[model samples]
Target: MNVGEWAAVIGAAGSLLGGGGFFVARATVKAARATAAAQQAAALATAAPAQQAANLAVLEATVRRVDEENGALRGEQARFRSLLRAFAWTVDRWAGQMHRAGIEPEPVHPLVEEYNRTGV
Candidate 1:
């Protein structure tokens, strides 16, 4: 072939090679990205159950702590109610003594009356 024709053939071959290399490189990069994404998804999938289990454990611990706190509060409430009842009894006994002595007793508190009525 003539030198000019040979040069033209070489130019065409170079252009095809360059374009094909670019396409191959682009395809390789795209495939690598997809593989990385799949790996990340698999890792997250494997970890999800462990994460959920940890969350459940934390929730159970919190519930147990709250229940214990509620139990302590109930004990305190019982003690307070007993003390209030004792106070009410003492007041009633004093009022009876005052009445027997011909002295007028103070009026009963509304709260004490409500507590007696509701047992709350």
Candidate 2:
């Protein structure tokens, strides 16, 4: 073959080989990426259930704690109400005693004012 024809043939062969190599490399890279993506997806799918279970356990624990606290607060409220009732009864008895002793009933406001002034 003539020099120009040989050059043309060599150039065509080189272009074909390069194109084929690029195609193979592209396909390999694509396959690797697809495999990595699938692995990642599988990992996430497996972890999702575990994460949800953990979250549920935490929520249940919180609910139990809240329920215990609420029960304690309810008991405290009952005791406070009982103490307030006793205080009211005692105050009524004292007022009755003052009335029976012929002492003029002082206004509760004066006693509160005096206590505030004394800081006692």
Candidate 3:
């Protein structure tokens, strides 16, 4: 109705609008922060399985290397056994020859048999 009253009304309306705008801006900022956090979590979730697979691949390779080493050790064991058996056979043949010539080979018989007990 009066110019002074009208000015007062306009001033109150402007204050309300300015306060509401500030609140809205603050809410927008909070929502943006929450969205950014959610996106980061999703990125980590997506990469987790790929990281696990890479770790498993490394473990599998280590297992294969160990298996190969075990195979090499088995081959070495077989060679050692063959060498022991050959030595035992040579001792036995020497004993037989000595026996035919009327020489007693009893003293070395037990030493040669020591090689046979290792397989058990």
What TM-score do all the candidates reach, one by one? 0.74, 0.65, 0.52
Model 1 per-residue lDDT at 39: 90
Q: How much lDDT does candidate 3 score? A: 0.76
- The clash tally of candidate 2 reads 0
* Model 3 TM-score on a 0 to 1 scale: 0.52
Predicted candidate 1: what Cα RMSD to the true structure?
Answer: 9.9
Pairwise lDDT winner, candidates 1 and 3: 1
User: Which regions of candidate 1 deviate over 4 angstroms?
Assistant: 1-16
- The TM-score, computed over Cα atoms with residue i paired to residue i, of candidate 2 is 0.65
Worst lDDT 10-window in candidate 2: 111-120
Residue lDDT tens for model 3, 1-120: 644454456556656887655555555566667777999999999999999999999999999999999999999999988988787778778889999999996675554556555542
Q: Which stretches of candidate 3 lie over 4 Å from their true place?
A: 1-43, 106-119
In order, how many clashes per candidate?
A: 0, 0, 0
Candidate 1 lDDT, tens digit per residue, 13-53? 65688765555555556666777799999999999999999
Worst 10 residues of 1 by lDDT: 2-11
> Which digits, one per residue and each the tens of the lDDT, describe model 2 over residues 16-108?
887655555555566667777999999999999999999999999999999999999999999987876677667768888999999877777
| Candidate 2 Cα misplacement greater than 4 A, ranges | 1-16, 109-120
